[model samples]
Structures are given as structure tokens and as C-alpha cells.
Target: MPPSPSTRSQAAAPPRRDRGDACPGALRLHQAADGHLARIRLPAGDLTVRQATALADAADLLGDGHLSLTSRGNAELRGLAEDCGARLATLLRDAGLLPSERHERIRNILASPLAGLDRHTPSDVRRWARELDALLCASESATALSGRFLFVLDDGRGDVAALGGDVSLLAESAGDGAGPAGSALLRVGDDPAALRIAGPDAPRAALTAAEAFLTAAAASGSGAWRVRELPDGHGLTARDVAGALRSAGIEAAYVAEPPAPATRTSPPYADSAAPGIVEGPDGDRALSVLAPLGRLTVAQWRLLTAIADADGSGALRLTPWRGIVLPGLPAATAPDRLAELSAAGLITDPASPWHRLGACTGRPGCAKSRTDVRADATAAVATGTTVPAEAPTGSPPSGVPVSPVGVPVSPAGVPVYWSGCERRCGHPHGTWVDVLATAEGYRVALVDPDTAPTAAPAPARTAAPPAP
Candidate 1:
């Protein structure tokens, strides 16, 4: 018998979705302004040497000669030919990148990129992610999940647990060499509370919770694509999820406001690990690098794949921060390999201007953008004009706090998002500077800076960012 769910109603229902999610997938290409865009889901951002080469080849032969990295650790190919869908699908399928066509779009998973590689991490959430992915593809019921549905696997290091996951499995501390057999917390949506269960059972528990969401969303008839979209007074709670898990014979201990990792990061996909070498506790080493502006050419992509194949492990770990980690590297040859990566235009230094900056595909790629935000942002960074992170297209918010002259950034690299318009599509959460592209130039504002602001707001300026 199935247990009843304890629904928690919100004060306000989320905006209703009348249409199906059009989020692009590998087979289902999206027609962008540049051309067809295909988003390839890499579960936990795990990529093999062969798979990486396939992508690079696809980008060069079919689409533009570039690969774009997403905040979910996935890769995107833009400027693709309108009729290249069949060839693209076949390439990915042969590489085993597309396992189940039916379940391809629903395989949105994010995990700690440094899982099993860093000393601070006690468990390898990557194993859990692989398990969950398999469960998703096998379950016919999971096919009903929206393409936008996301699952986050966070190791005890607290790297990727809070990037707005629909179903988040946070690995609890299991001491040294606990592996993946430790206990974990299963958090649904953004609820501060969680339900604890065995680590080995974490994957199953995640699937169960997601299934519960489907049931709730169906009952609500809200056409919600994500758990957070459930209407007010019709939401699922920790109690509801626990009831579902227990029905499956999985034990779930409830924790009111589960304790978060002490070293947690805010949203907008900040890179917790700097670009360079990461040493595991066992004396193993990995070479880390970042893509400038979250876009990579096939040349750069192949270079990374070659470096990984030669010096590091044959696998590439794509971080949620839009970075890559080449793990299991030979210690003696890592420095030379890293030098090669740096020379090839990859961001290898933490202090590099490209480290904390991100921008959407504005200008020619996106028809909605007012201007080329990326070019302006690059210019801003070059001139030391303090750049912020991503923003979307829409009207600017009134009564916003205005930023003072100059884009001041923290030493730890607070990200600045640049958008062609006001949608603020992928902007970083928490406090950040808002640099909106106005017809005159860029309108700079201090969004959610401090408790509030005083005095009159600064006027928008038309001057181009001065050179450094």
C-alpha cells in the first residue's frame, strides 16, 4: 500500500506552464538564431577520451567549430546545420553518449566535479549519480519527467548541493575512505529540511522522490515542469517524500533544517576549485582548467581531450562551474601538461581575468539580445571595468540599488553576469552587481547589495568601459 503524502501549500502558486518544456536535447535540436542548438547531457559531467573526441568532431563537422558548456555540466553545440540532426544523433549514439533515446532529455544530473578526487570529500557522489541515471532510464514512469528536471549529487565537500536541484542527494560525512556506502540526505526542491537514508540507497530514494513529485504534479494538474513549480497549497514536503520512500521499504530519518556544509557556495555556478592542480589525499594529482566565457572551440576541446588521454586519466570531469578537471594525472608530467593547456588559451591561473566572469550567447546567436554582451564584457574585463555575471532579457527593475562607478570584485572572485537585455536568464544568486545592456550603453546597478541602498540612483552611462 502506498502512504499518503503530506502536502505543504505555498502562500502563492508558481507561474503556471501551459506548454510542454521545449528544453533542447541531443536528438531534439533547438533552432537558435545562430542555427540548430543541441544540448548533450553528461551525467555528472563525466566524459571519456573517446566521447570527448566525438563531441569535438561533431562541432567541427556539423555545427560551428565550438562547444559551449552549460551550468549543469552539459555541453552545447551551436551554429549547426538545419538538416544535420540525423548525422549528429548517430555520432552521439555510436559514442554511447545517447544511451536511451526516450530518456535522453530527462537525464539532467549535477554532481561535485571533485568527487572522489579531493581529500575534503569523504564519498564519491559520482557513483551515486551513475546509479541514479541508470534507474531513471530503466523506469518508464521516469519518462514522464520534464526535460528540465535536475538531480544534484553533492559529496560531503558541499560543492554542488545547492545549485537549485529538483532532487538533491547530499552525501553525509562517512569519515576517511567511507567510499559511497555512507548515509546521505535526500532533499527535495529548496526545502531547508531533508530526510536521511542509507548512502547506498540514495539513488533509489532520489528516484522515489521524483516519482512522488510526478504524482503530486498530476494531482495538482498544474503542468509543473519542476518541483518548485507546484502551485501553492499543493506542494510536496519532506514528510511526503519520506512516506513515499518508506512505502518502497526504504528507511528515511527526517531532519528539520538539515545542517548544510560549512563551506558551501551560493548559486550561479561559482567555481569552488581554482584553475590549476588538485592533489588527492593519496598523493594523486589532477590538472584543472576553465573555459573563457563558458565557450570552447573544437581545437581547445580536442587539446583537453588529448592532454587527458596522455598525462591524466582518460576521463574528464566537467564542473558545474563551467570548468573541466582532468583527473588521475601523472605527477611528474602534470606541470608540463598544464603549461600546454595554458598556452592553448585555457584559463589555468586563478587570477586570470576570465576566472570569475560569465556571459550568455548574446548578439548573433540569440535573437532576443539587444547587443553582444560577451564582447562588451570582454572589453570591460580588459579595461579593468569590474565585470559581473549573467543577466537575462526584459525590462529593468525599478527602485533598484545603483552600483557606484567601477566594478569592484572580491579577491575570491565574485562572478559578474552580463546580459544583452533584462531577462537575467542565468545570473548568479545572492548579492551581485547588475550590469544591464541599455541602448545607450550598460546600466550598472547594485542589486541586493547590502541590506538596502540610500540616496538617488545613479544615471545610466553611455561611455564604453575604459581600458585598463
Candidate 2:
């Protein structure tokens, strides 16, 4: 069994120092081999339909026609020209996407993408997430947080919780009048146990906790920006975090142990029959959609805009899993609209190829990559390989796909991911098959959950492979 939340402990290590983090943003673009790379922070992954359309337009006008999704639930516009930052910033600002220039990069927040929409979730994690973003943006010192710093808000489920956040607030059931129906448990590093605070105070408490972390990191003289990198002696404690919350006027308590949130393997998708009615706990429903491989062509992007125009009432939630959910649609029009989206290759089914496959900007877009991993993965998929399916409660068995093309890939199963090099960007969580590029060609490895890690020998191929 996975370690319970209460039993988890922080690592003991001295703090390490760093000058500062240089993660780029819309305002501060990073020059890549292809062009400029600009990451747009979508706190709680919320974007208006207009905002989504603007991003698509930006990609077409200032960067590549394609958009890349970050593991942090942010969007990346690559292949941008040298002079596109100011233009891009202005465009996003007008669209209500760029709220704070200084805080844009540091505005890293992940929440339950399907919260309020998913049947099993208790509350809309988006509300808490937005409140937290507002708090962070309003803070004068929050600019100190590195662009890479992350915050996760899970609604009593272990989805985003598994992504390994720097500061996390997992929601739990609460008592009436004690607080909202849910409480927030704060976690630092990978520790299981966390400090609990009122649901209403969760945003404020999280801000205070982050401030405390920054102060500790500075005091230790370890220049560490991330909680986990803090040296042994400089590690944070639940008691210390509780004290910080109290100082900030937010009530908090250290729980000896908290229940480990359950993990949900299924990705969010629209209910074809119900449409806007998102399934929640006890047969409830919500509006949800997937961004294929988290990349959208201009045409596909337009389709999303059309859906938003027809179904979404001016709001769309960008999920941390690189998808979108539109809440409050008319039940009558939703099914037909969802059908249109499904016809366009958006995965509304729990099991779909787009949900299972993820790849980085390899080859032409990235100078460091040895091959176009995305193209390669697409080629592999076309070969009719039977993508892996989600394993049962027991340990997963090992094997490669039997057929390569037209097979549904399971997000929770050991699916295949291609990398330009050893740095496998956008790699999926849980079990997976790794195909790494080398000077001698691709090296295939099957990651096993039950035994020591080992690599599978590459299959012999003809001098020339089939066209992708």
C-alpha cells in the first residue's frame, strides 16, 4: 500500500543555494533553438473562451502554429520570433490572461481540473485555486518564488497530488460550521502528513506557508528555491508551518496523520448524453474536454472556441492534466456539441490515444533533441501496436505493445513515450515504456514496477523504416 498521508516525513538535508531560477514566461521569453519559448501561467487552469482563442491566435501569429503543454499545467508557445515578447504580452494582457507581469512566472498553481465537474469530487478546487492565485499575486514578496515553484490543490483525490508539488493543499471532508464541507491539508516536500486548515482559510494559509518556506530557505543561506532541495538541517517542519499560519491570522493544526487521498485513474471527458451535466459524487455530471496531446492546431483550436461559444458560458477550466472543462452548459445542446468535438479527435472517452500519449518538442523545435520524438511516437502508434491498458490492483506485467496503430492507450497503464534524449520531457506518471534516442538509434526500455529496472533490447529493423 502507498504510504498514508500522516506517516510521510520530510527529508533531512542541509539547504543548497542558487543564484535564482530562470524559468521563462510570456513577458520573459527564453530563446530556444527553434525560436523564443514563452510559458503562459494558467493558475487553476482557468481560461475564458476568448482567452483560449487568443492563445491560438498568438501561436499562429507570434510562434509556431502548435502549442505545448507543460507538466505544471501551463501552456508553452514555442518557435516564437525574437521580437514577439512585447506583442505576445500585450495580446495576452488584453485577453485577461496576463494579470501580473512580475508575478506571471511565479503564478504556478495546479488544482483538481475536473473538480466540481467530476462525480467523485466534493467541491470546486478552482475556487480555492483562484483565491490562492489572487493572494500570491497580491503579495509583495511572492515574487521571490522561483518560476519553477509549484502549488497543487487537490479535491480529496490523488491526481495532481502525485505530480510532486513544492507546496500542496489536499482537500478533505469537513464538519458543518467547523468550516466548509472540505478542509485543506498543507504539505511541504513529499511528506505524507500535512497541516490542516479551514477550507475558507486554505488560500491564505497556503500563502503564509509559502512565505515561511521562502524565509527558511533564505535564513539557511542555502539559496534553495525549492523545499526539497533544502539541506538536511534546513528542512521545514509541520510545527513551524502551523506557527506561520497563526502569525498570518489563519488557524491551522498539525495532524499526526491524515487519510491518504484516493487516486482516480480515469481522465475527465464530456458525458455524450448529458452534455453540460457533469457527473459528480452520486451520479452528478459536468462538461469536460481534452486537448489532444496537449497540442492544438489552429483549426482544432477554432473548434474549441466554437464549443466554448456554443456550450461554455464564457468560462473554461484548464485542467492540470492538459485538458479543459466547461461548466454550466445547457443540457439540451451539450450532447450534439460534444459529438462534434469527439469527431475532431478530442478524446472524450476515458480510454483514448490522445490521453495516453505525450511527447516533447523534439528535433526541429529543440536543438538538444536527437529525433522528433512526437513524430516518432506518431509513427509507432500508426503501426497498429496494442497500447497497454490500465493494470489491476496487483503489480503490472511487463511487455511491449502487440499492435502499434489505432490502439487505445491507457493513461494509468504502462504506455510508450518517446524522448529525444535522456531528459524525457512530458513523461507520464505511473507505469510507462521509455524509448530514448542515442547515437546508435533508439533505446527501448520497459519500466517495471515489481523488480529492478532493466532495458529491453532494441528490435532489429530494416535499413529503411516506413514513412511516418
Q: Whose lDDT is greatest here? A: 1
Q: Tell me the tens digit of each residue's lDDT in model 2 across 1-468.
A: 122332223222433444676667888787777888888899977778889889999999988797766666778888899987788988999998877888998898988776766556665577888898998889999999977678888887677776657888888765322234667778877555688787888888888878988998888888776776676677777787888887888888777666676656533222121212365454423456666567767776678777777656666766655666776566677777777778877667655555556666688877778988777767655664443455332222333353343222232444556677655666644346666778987765555433434442222122211000
lDDT tens digits by residue: candidate 1, 1-468: 011122212123475766667778898888778998999999999999999999999999998899988888889999999899999999999999998999999998999888778777754588999999999989999999988788988886666665768899888774523323488888888677889899889999999999999999999898888888898777888889999998999999998867665454333335566799888878879888999888888999999999889877799988767789999987788889889999999999987877767677888987777998787777656665323333333322332212333333222435666767656555544344566677877765544423342111232111211000
lDDT of each: 0.76, 0.67
TM-score of each: 0.86, 0.83
Weakest ten-residue segment in model 2 by summed lDDT: 459-468
lDDT of 1 at 440: 75
Clashes of each: 19, 33
Give the CA lDDT, 0 to 100, for residue 10 in model 1: 16
